[model samples]
Target chain A: MRRIMVCVKRVVDYNVRIRVKPDGTGVVLDGVKMSVNPFDEIALEEALRIKERGEADEVVAVSIGPDDAQQQLRTALAMGADRAILVKTTDVVEPLAAAQVFLTLVQKEQPQLVILGKQAIDDDAAQTGQMLAALWDRPQATFASKVELAGAAALVTREVDAGLETIEVDLPAVVTTDLRLNEPRYVKLPDIMKAKKKPLDVVELASTGVSAGETLKSVLVEPPKPRSKGVMVKDVAGLVDALKKKGLL
Target chain B: MATVLIVGEHDGSKLNPSTARCVTCAAQISGAEVHVALFGADLAAVAPQAAALKGVTKVLSVANPANAHPLAAVLAPQVVALAGPYTHVLGPSTTFGKDLMPRVAALLGVPQVSDAMSVDGPYKFKRPTYAGNAIVTVEAPESRKLVATVRTASFEAAPQGGQAAVEAVAVSVPLPTHTRFVSVSAANSDRPDLQTAAKVVSGGRALGSKENFQLIYSLADRMGAAVGASRAAVDAGYASNELQVGQTGKIIAPELYVAIGISGAIQHLTGIKDARTIVAINKDAEAPIFEIADYGLVGDLFQILPELEKSLA
Candidate 1:
């Protein structure tokens, strides 16, 4: 049976307004609620599709975040993952260390394929999946728009600046899901109830012998400031004349 | 002793403009030697282009039949092997570099830094995180080799004067058998590439229709600029997905960027933060694009663009 692991992240809900602080460290999400990132939901859908097609025997969802991330894991389970693994940490971890935790999990789980959102909504770095693939010394296909599973390998097509490029890599490789991948499915009432019974494994970050505090120098949080509003022009001709006078045209 | 290796991005015949930008960035760090490494079927054609950059001291060319195709799988191992002696590896933050740099970093068991706007200390660097909203300074643990994908627009392209000597390097690793370029159909546009273009003109949902985007293209054409679009414009079916620029879309840093009718969402700003001079034309004085813009015009882009086109004409 082919084993597949999908990584998910908990982030500020899309509906909430994000405010930047003065210091430029982080954002203010006071009244705003948090939820699973939208892109990760897409990743989960892709994995579920493979499992539904009998392309894989099992689908496992994993997250490296605070205990609150269990909510996202539960949602993944509700969507059809067979199990969940939460690499729990009290403090926020940096991308480098978070990648190490994922690598450790991969070492233990030995899944034939690994999948993750192209980027988390919070950091939006888009580094972990590619970093994890590098650390494991395995080939990776990132920003995949389409994925085709083969007997012992998979053919992945990625979006590039010049054009699309396709590559076939052996199994047990990593593939990061992009926004163009698929529209995520919503959990039904019955599946949400079934998710409560799904197996949930919580592992502490300390158990991996990786220091979250040490990995990151410090936490910098600030709200993003609003941009100044400019005047709107009524027509193209007048705006052009205005620009030409200003030498901007 | 910390040498920097730049992976050449162009087809073996010419030095990509981004490579010159990468060279300028590497030169900013003191005591770092910048060398350009070329891999492909033709080294003779690519060497002079590498040798022309101002700060580049050496040009290393690795020629093999396997490199005829530009897949990351074929290029990553060769880069890893070539990067053995250097402490830093730099590439332009384009689609190809974005795909290959991490693999090289992973091969070296180190973290790959993405979209670095500026570097402060020698090894410790400052890079944007959370989609350009915040910047972080990171210290690599004892690892000598650091891999970074440099944002092309963030740095000035290096001057061309230095006499860089070219030498051939050998590659023994076999290429992957599964991947090959079947065919490519690139959209032929008169405008410049959004990433490297010095000027860009973008539209948003306020444009009302795809036909109106011609105003953007006309103005861009007059100025020899590239065309871009907000996510809203793309979703509204006014522009192709390839032209979209935002947090989840393509990041662009042209010398001059013109935003037309865009409401200035945070996601869109993240992509254009690096543009040296931003000009915003929106009806809403409250539109966010005006905040970061170097110049602002409060008017309808529909009227502004055609007038501007006539003025340029």
Candidate 2:
């Protein structure tokens, strides 16, 4: 393989318990901690591993977001991506638009493989990779837990609802990473310094020949209803008695 | 009338219950004439089951040798070919639908509403984001065909009373051969499926090891409940990947959910928020699982497991 393009997105850190605004507009993002989407980090780690194993020559990290997303791309470079590309935009890029941008880049880079997260934590809309594959007219293996390249095809083990399902797709396919894929390696301090010197090219979203087609509009935003506090039972006998009382036994 | 075409999910033998739940969601749309599309090598047993769903009016059965497996690349084109007559295209928000619907949306040049939990109107839906921490009402354009994946957990399965007509349709789209199905290794169990189970028993990292995790299976079997695990237990190799119940794993809604030796993380809670009744048993009294549990017990699970099973017996 010549090159592998990995897609990364900036999202609220996983540990943060997000709170919706009182006005019911959107989540508060004033001073929250942000990092690379966990699934995307795993995808980048897989790409780097493929490159390190001599299967691919270069790994390019790409993202579409505001300028702050550069911080996440730099982290990708620090984690060993050969270079990074940031498609600059201030507007919200929905999954369809994001797929279009990736499609353009895929045609330009002609990478043998493209990897991305199954879903971004913020939107939880797991659509980009499959949509991109449709636009690119290529094969898509999503929710991949294990990927092995053999000859001109890749065997991917996906984490499906029933169990593990393995499929084979020809080269130049798109794979979306699942949680069990791999634990991402941490970016060390020296690698951070080296990453600062890596070539990161920034381009406008409009220049990619893709429009931010925002079709769905958010009419209202609200927090989830909290569960009511419960009672503590003294013993297993009491638990059984209580469950029977509630008709749950 | 708004024509809503639902993609039916099946495993060659029978239709998945998720398809019925999608039918329920589609019924919420005003004046929706629901039809199910089943793509498989043979629809002998599954087509009748799809037509039996309460609100389904017709079953579009596309039988082909290449439709043996649910490949997104192969199914998306066929779905687009059949989508011209319908106004809305819907599928369950399971792995099968999640993998295929977006590709259909892109091919149709329309945006998709993923995990639509509520149908506010024909083009408006309410969906959860941030792992169920936030809910947003989204409105799609009425000019284009609307494609969506229904959140099965949020809707009840439609009753089996309808006598919908079944139509065997042949699609003439060119299927791709670049993606091939190799094999699937599914966990064979007599226990009910965790996704559609009425009762669920979930273990956590506190279960200690693979051997100790058997306590959970024993309790679940005794209670006739499905078995699930927290991500920690799966990561520690105490449980298999498919048994994990969390935001990244399976989002399920059951009548009763019992959490034993599990400290509830928000991620895990996201999966069970819709469960009707929750019971928690943990040694630590401060475990977050107790907050949402309708009944909480603080004790050693080893001691409680045997007692609970004996009481059930």
Docking class of 1: acceptable
Q: Per-residue alpha-carbon lDDT of model 1 for B1-313, expressed as tens digits?
A: 6689999888666667888988988987788899998888777887888898888999998888878756676788899888878888998887778777876776776666676666665566666656666566655553557888887767888998989999898978766654455444456676688877878999999999999888888888889889999988876778876788877778887777899899888788989887766788888887778878767788766776777777678
- Write down the lDDT of every candidate, Cα atoms only: 0.78, 0.95
* Fraction of native contacts under 8 Å reproduced by each candidate: 0.34, 0.90
List chain B TM-scores, each candidate.
0.92, 0.99
Among all windows of 10 consecutive residues in model 1 chain B, the one with the lowest summed lDDT is B177-186
**TM-score per candidate:** 0.89, 0.99
Model 2: CA > 4 A from native? none
Q: What TM-score results for chain B when candidate 1 is compared with the true chain B?
A: 0.92
Candidate whose DockQ is highest:
2
Looking at model 2 chain B, which ten-residue stretch has the lowest summed lDDT? B241-250
Query: Residue-wise lDDT of candidate 2 within A146-232, one digit each (tens)?
Result: 999997999999999889999999999999999989999989999999999999999999999888846899989999889888889
- Residue-level lDDT of model 1, residues A1-249, one tens digit each, is 678889888888765556666675556756668788887888889988998898988999999888888998999999999999999987867666777888898898898889988777776667778778777767677878788898888888776666466777877788887677777887899999999999999988889987765443424444334345434445555556555666655
